[model samples]
Target: MQEISRVFDAERIQWASATASGHTVNSAEAYQATGVSDLLPRSPRQLVFVECDVLGLEPAEVCDHHNPGDPGYDRQPQEYLQGSSLGQVLSLLGKEPTHEQRIIAAADHCLTHAYRGECPGVDPAELADWRERSRAARFGLTHEEIQMRIRIATKALERAERIKVG
Candidate 1:
């Protein structure tokens, strides 16, 4: 749990009972507080335009694990963004690669890292052993600082996910 907090606020999340989907989700104000919430989605509507097509599901599920809030969860947009985030990550690194590797390798790290500070020991190889260690570092930021980072990263992550590669 510390490792999760190192990158996010587990407390910031709660089961959104007012959901159309079965997976745990959030209202926008609620999500913006999480820091782990998707990104820059002023309304769920903007999510589709960014190609987060699966967002048609619901915001609540973003938090739910097996019991998912409404729809359990769909793999479409999630998989789609997995493919897309990989392409961009590789292109930026001047490489060509498979999608799964990219998601496992980078998308996750990008999701955890906050804007206000560096995530100490951010080694990709360390990720496997990281969970326990992360619990201690929880939020390298103060509360107000974390909120600011959330605002900045929301737009940034959204744009990153929305990127269209040529």
Candidate 2:
């Protein structure tokens, strides 16, 4: 979300997370949850539904990679299918992913073996550190702890050298 915002220079982009509740939430439900409508009067709104099915919305408005029949899923290169939502969003924005982004994509896709053997140029220690930070961020860290992890991860990524992967 931050990367996308930076790329587009968006003045404001409100965000809200909805519980899966054993199934993905519809776009309308996600929109209502944002409460952005109440904050702003009736106006044109661009709602981007990531990793969720769209309801009363066009396929182009979504960024899901789970439904095989969905355009979002069909559009991705086979190798990138594992990268999922992040890959889809980056592709949708026509952005060339950075080295850190590539690492994240690979990690998120569970390509541990590939990074360990196939991409030998990537340092295992750095990758492990990143994975630890990522897991901490996702699993129950307080807001402050998550922020600290992000800062540490960001610095580590900045210092990392880019390496080619087959």
Candidate 3:
């Protein structure tokens, strides 16, 4: 969400609850939450719906991989599955996925599988550290703690050496 906001220079970042299935949010609900009305004429103020179904919007406006029949889901490469949304958004923004972003995609899909060579050239220790951080961030963290974690991770990445193996 933060990445999307940064790319679009979005004025606001809002969170919307997923629908009954817990896999996706209703497009209408998401738009409402974001204060984007489909009825309004399209303008420079675009609403790029990430990981949500498109109810009354064009396919180009959405970046998701959860619904099989939806254009967003169909556009994703089969191997990436759940992890494709971020890459899709990055591609749409004319940016390549960074190594860390690739790691994030692989981790989101399946960390264990990713460690077993799916995400080649990435260090397992780094992956494990990310897993720990993810687990820690999943519950009971205040905003300050989250910010602290982000800062620590950023600093660690800056100091870390990249290692690639065949």
Candidate 4:
């Protein structure tokens, strides 16, 4: 556990296949294993903490967490998790502004891509293309594997100290 945590501490990107499991997906225990809780976003809300739910899964399954803050002021364990489906659960998230990356995404309003149907002016063909690209990129992921990778990526980005890939 200590060795793996060392790796997570050094790399904020995806976890290697050896260390992850369903139980540790969103728990503080996982964060502890990585030893990098201090670097997470300040938001009481964890949704915006996610830069991309682009991982091939339902929106509900993205890095979901449930952090019931402690009795007083100390918001221990955060209030979010990495894989959820309930709207009400989303509501309980921390009420803080998104971190910088999220702000950039919101400024672009990329979420609109998900519901482009509502935007009469946007081209339908464009939406189809986007979906295709996303599908192509996620070709290797099973429905469940997709959800799991997204959760780990989201949490690591939000809380891990540093992340890099080669």
Candidate 5:
């Protein structure tokens, strides 16, 4: 555990492989044994984070849609997330947002492509392609595997002392 955690903690990124899982379609090993792949979005927070980064926007910019008091708050995504079919499912499962909420609250809005629907200065087709890719990436992963990746990432974040944000 320490060895694997060390890899995740290093400034330079490293990759490892899981022994074997019947689910993976490529490389026979989950990415660094974390079960992540180029094909998947990991989680909503990661998906939004990457999208925000690609668009030269911060998660806060995307998340402000969640905060009613913010000047730039959009309200639409928040309302939609709260009322969408996915939202109802999450509620039914009693799984309220955790990492996703913190990530959005830190930035102040919904940063997802689906949530945003259309973004200015961004090619809608490109965003749609990314969304599709994310869905595909997660295809082979089981729910448990996905959650395991999130838990490991959360642990790494908790252990981080200086994230070197610019």
Candidate 6:
């Protein structure tokens, strides 16, 4: 079991019985100093989205794992990102991804490193040599295409950052 610092006073939490999707589900309860009770989200997708939104990440950054166009698309969320601080927090909350969520993340891995040309390992000159031996396998793009995608993804990321900052 993993423990996390209390978002509120430790005394303010409890286990609450609930039902979700017609199935019995357990929920975490948080009580305010005033004695008001709140329940955390039960769905993994909603939990992840809330965390990503709170972190100011673009939807695509966290939710691009299941894109149909990715060459290596396998419908999982990017494994690497899920190991980050945000992901760790989610894990502590028992809001881990479902099988479909994992698949979505897997797809994002391809889009970020391959289609968007944002990965450090992507080398235009040696693409053919490493294409099949890499996570971005068979995701080779022409130098011009890579450059274009890099520019686009960068601009979009910049825009998202600006939005976050503002």
RMSD, every candidate, angstroms? 18.4, 11.0, 11.0, 18.4, 19.5, 16.9
Q: Model 3: per-residue lDDT, tens digit, 66-99?
A: 5675334543223543346666677766677777
TM-score: model 4 vs. ground truth = 0.22
Q: Considering every candidate listed, which one attains the maximal lDDT?
A: 3
The reply for model 3, stretches above 4 Å from the true place, is 1-47, 70-83, 138-166
TM-score on alpha carbons, each prediction:
0.20, 0.48, 0.52, 0.22, 0.23, 0.20
Report the error of model 6 at residue 72, Å: 21
lDDT of 4 by residue, 89-113 (tens): 2233332222322222221233353
Regions of candidate 1 where Cα sits further than 4 Å from its true position: 1-45, 48-125, 139-166
Looking at model 3, residue 81 earns an lDDT score of: 32
Give the Cα-based TM-score of candidate 1 against the true structure.
Answer: 0.20
Please report, as a residue range, the 10-residue window in candidate 1 with the lowest summed lDDT: 46-55
Flag the better candidate by lDDT, 1 or 6.
6
Give per-residue lDDT, candidate 6, residue 26: 27
The digit string of per-residue lDDT tens for model 6 on 61-83 reads 33222234332234323343343
Tens-place lDDT digits, model 2, residues 62-124? 655555654345432324433445556677666667666656554544456535634423455
lDDT tens digits, residue span 1-166, model 5: 2222232345233322222232322432322233322343344532222111122223322211223443334444435434232332234335554433322222223446433543323344444444344444658765556557667998999998975778
Give the higher-lDDT candidate: 1 or 2.
2
lDDT of 1 by residue, 59-165 (tens): 32132212223121232323322223333333333454433343333333343441212323234344433432343347464545555665798888877856579
Question: Which of the predicted structures, 1 or 4, would earn the higher TM-score when compared with the native?
Answer: 4
lDDT of 5: 0.36
Error of 4 at 78 (Å): 30
